[model samples]
Target: MLRDFSAQALFMGLLTAFVGFASSFAVVLHGLTGVGASEAQAASGVMALSISMGLCAIVLSAWTRLPVSIAWSTPGAALLASSGAVEGGFAAAVGGFLICAALIVVAGLWKPLGRMVAAIPATLANAMLAGVLIGLCFAPVKAVAFNPAFGLAILGAWAVVGAFNRLLAVPAALVAFALVLTFGIDIPDGAFSAIARDLLPRPEIVAPVFNLPGLVSIALPLFVVTMASQNIPGIAVLKVNQYEPNPGPLFAATGIFSFLSAPFGGHAVNLAAITAAMCAGEDAHADPRRRYWAAINAGVFYVVFGLLAGAVTAIVNLAPPILIQAVAGLALISAFAGSAMNAFKEAETREAAALTFLTTASGVSFGGISGAFWGLLAGGLVMGVGRFVAARKAKKV
Candidate 1:
């Protein structure tokens, strides 16, 4: 393991963790608060998620000798953000998180269930994700309207960095945001002190309370999004890079950690999609056998980052909510683009995918259920009708 370590791999691993967290931490915070977590609880949630994913990455990489990066479910967070507060509030949300984690564990243990989850159409899944992202992606423009100076600076920084290295764009924008906050705007005298007080995150366990509405509305959608957007794509990423570790055990490991962390305010954890590529790809290491070190290093970095959750959360809270959201929107641009591309790529599924995207993007709520769940349902119905019509046409011909 010592011999396998290389400067390139170590750098790549740390870079992946830094970039991933900096880009998306806002979304995680927003998601937790959207579900009714207090500021402290949200900070705890971030810490729990970071530590859990970190441990998962470390253990999985060591056991499999593969670059198996784990991540908090970004799309799942987006789903929660859109879903808003349910009947029983944050406790209910915690219950839903537990349920989702249980589902993931079952999927890992049960072959047929895993197969069924895998059978979800890629177009529909991508469309659902795209729809969830559409509203959030508009935040930069909204930020410009709300606070022109700060907004423009943030957007400009993102644009400039993206022009060169897309991966660095959001992190660069975050830096620009910090600079603008420091020099461009006035800070309240005691604000920094308040932020400093929360520098070290303390876990706050919220007891889970299961209810039918939360189960259908939050749990099911969270499960679907995490599996479809994170887990399935994560496997594909590793497979593409010629690392085919067993999916079941990996899923089970994430599921277990997610379950353990949920009581402490964490949401879902799963195999990473984007960062997995960073660690698993050739850029991480020339020798595939040595690439596991990248994942290990990433895990270590993630744990350290988790320990700094308080500071990060405090910094984010210092900004206007819209600005934070704007940064998050910028972070999700690539995901939205990718989802849109795949959602419309197939002519046969285009209409269904469009229906899904529109429904999810609408942010509609009915009977306590989120637009994402309704969107997937509506899309599936359309897909079924399309298949039926195609079959009839074939018979007539």
Candidate 2:
């Protein structure tokens, strides 16, 4: 393993950590607060998620001898943001997180469970995700309307750097956001003192409150989004890089970590898709066999970064909420585009996918179940009818 260490691997690993953390922590912060977490609680959630994913990556890569990268469920966080405040508040949301983690664990241990999730229509899944992200994706524009100077600054940073390196675009925007916070926003008295106090996070164990609304709104949709968007795509990325590690254990490992972190305010952690490529690809190492070291190094960096999550939360809290949301929206644009493209990729499924996207984007809820779940269900029903009608026509012919 020592012999496998290389400068290229180390550098790529560091870059992966920086990009992954910088790119989306605002989303996590906004998601947590949207669901009723205090700044302290949200910071704890961020810290827990960061450390959990890092540990998951390190352990999985070591055990499987493959470049395995783990990440928090960014899509799931978006779902939470869309779902808004639940009945029992953040505690209930934590309960939902527990259920989602349990499902992921079952999906790994039980082949039937995994297959059932995999059987979901890709178009509907992508549509549902795109719908979930629509509100956040619009934040940048709204941010500009709210405050052009700050908002355009953030967008300009992303657009300029994005032209050269797509990977660094969000990070550049994050840097721009820090500048906005520093030079633009007026500081309140004692805000700096509070930030210094929160520089080190203290994880809080939340008591789970299970209810039907939380179960349907938070748990079910979160499980589907995390698995379909993050975990499965992560596996595909590894396979594309010619790694042959079994997917079951890797999924289970992430679920276990998510479960551990959920009690401490973290929503979910799972396999990485975007960052996995950096660790698994040739950029990490010429020898595919040696690329696991890159993931390991990334895992190390993640843990170090996790220690600073509280400070991040503290600093971000001082900014206007919409400005932070603008940063989140910028971070999610790429994900939104990819998902929207896939949602309507097939002509046969286009109508159903459109229905899913529209239903989810409406953000309507019934009996506490979120629009994401309803969107998928409605799309499935319509899709089923379309197939059935075609089948009957064929018989008549």
Candidate 3:
């Protein structure tokens, strides 16, 4: 294994960790804040997720000798962002995280449970995700509306750098945001001192408070999105790169880590879809057998980053919320586009998909349930009725 460690693998691994963390971490922070987490709680969540995923990536890569990357559930975070504040605050959200993690574990250990999740129609699944993301996708514009100077700076950085390399766009936007924080926003004289003091890493264990509304709204939606959008696609990415490992064990491993981290306010962690390519692909190494080193390398950096999560969260909190939100919105644009495309791709299911998208985007809530759950329900009902009507027509003929 030591002989297989090439400079190329090391570089790719470092790059993978940077891109993965830099791109979507804002989304994680935003989502955590959205669900009524205090600054300390949100910081703890980010810290927990980063450390757990980093360790998971290392263990999985070393165990399988495959570039099996792990990540916090980005889509699940987006779902939380869309779900609005839970009825019982961050504690309730943590409770949901526990439930979601348990579901993931079950899905991995029990074939029937995994199969049931897989049975969800792809179009409806995509539609529901699209609906959840549409609002955040517009945050760039909203940020601009909130403050044209800061917003445009971030967008401009993304646009210019994105033209050169799409993968770096979000990270570039993140750079612009740092500039905005440094030179643009006027900080209170002592804010920096306070942030510095808060930088010390400490895990805040939030006690869980389970509620029925939280289960249906947070746990259910989070589980579905994480599995469908992150875990399943992550496996496919690895397969595309020709590194096939048994996915069930991988899923179970991530679930176990997620469960362990939930008490510290982490939402969820799972197989990484986008960054998995970076670790598993030829870019990681010339020799396919050695690509696992890249993931392990990335894992090391993730742990390092996790240790600094408190600092990062504190720095981010200094800025106006919209600026961070804009960056997060930039990060999620690709996810939203892909989901929208998949949702409406088939003509037969387009109506149902559209309906789902519209409803989810509307951000409706009734009886303590979120729009995402309702949208999925509505789409499934429409699809079921359509299928029934078609069957009846064939019988009449």
Candidate 4:
């Protein structure tokens, strides 16, 4: 079963695996900044999530002979940076992690909640995903305005790779990344000395505190956003890749990871769809049995990356901000388009789906949870009622 392991496959897999870790570091750090975390705390949390995901991915993938890669939850990080930045600060952000972990643990333990989540319709889920990611997509366009040259370079690279995908195959993102780096396009600029000085080999943990304001206003909303925005799409990615594992165990693992790391500022952990797709593809390993090694390879890199957290931070800082924004936006384009298309595909329920999309895009917040979750819920309820009414009328006839 472990017969075929080409060097090329290993290289592609490893490259793809490093993507989210490297790409999202800036955003994570920015989020930390928003929450008033010192640069050191922000970097440490990033290191923790990277190392934890790497370890978990290695064990799970090798044990199951499946290509299971994990990354810091992008949506979770986004929510933390935005809302968790307000009111309660970093400690409040920790509260968010604790709340999300507890809820996930309960869901993992009780099958009913999982089932209810599963019962949500596919189109609606896609719509929710689109809404959740709309901000991410438009972010790059805005970045171009900030730094036209760098943003355009990244976009141009994407266009070149996409046009040649048939010939270039899986190396497109890698090539694009290389070209941007080589072209003297600066995305961010953190000096090597500054990064080395800021490195934290040991992390300081902040114990969970229960403030009604923190939990209800901050933590609860963050939890809702993580579950609704991050977890759902993560699971969908798994299903899309035909590696749909037991949801209970998966959620359990995430909860356990989150619970353990919350005090140290670890925000959220979940199965990664974009990065995971790299491992699931035929290119990662022709023989499915050995594909797990690709994830193991990624995990190994993650551990190594964790040890060099300071250097990694420095490197991210050197890259231009526009590059980060453009790449992130470009990477997520397919996901956004897919979600939007599904959101409005049906005639009868299209209006409800539109409501969800618009509300989510508006970025409104009642408490801590982003509008994406509430938007989907409200739209889904309306659609469900419409279906129920139509079915009842048909039965009477």
Give the clashing pairs for model 2: none
lDDT of 3: 0.93
lDDT of 2 by residue, 1-397 (tens): 7888899999998999999999998899889888888887898999999999999888988888899999999999999999888889999999999999999999999999999999999999999999999999999999999999999999999999999999999999999999999999999989988878767778888899999888999999999999999999999999999888788888889899999999989999999999999999999999999999899999999999998998888888788999989989998998999999999989999999999999999988888788889999999999999999999999999
Go through the candidates in order and give the clash count of each. Answer: 0, 0, 0, 12
Candidate 4: tens digits of C-alpha lDDT, residues 192-274: 45656766566757665665555654455455555555566666765776775666776777777777767777777766667
Candidate 4: segments with Cα more than 4 A from true spot:
1-9, 30-36, 81-86, 165-190, 199-204, 211-245, 314-323, 367-369
In model 3, the clashing pairs are none
Give Cα distance to truth, residue 106, candidate 4, Å. 3.2
Model 4 TM: 0.80
Candidate 4 has an lDDT of 0.66
lDDT of 4 at 152: 66
Candidate 3 ranges with C-alpha deviation above 4 Å: none
Error of 2 at 354 (Å): 1.1
Question: 161, model 3: CA deviation in Å?
Answer: 0.5
lDDT of 4 at 218: 49
Which parts of model 1 have CA positions greater than 4 angstroms off?
none
lDDT of 1 by residue, 270-293 (tens): 999999999999999989999998
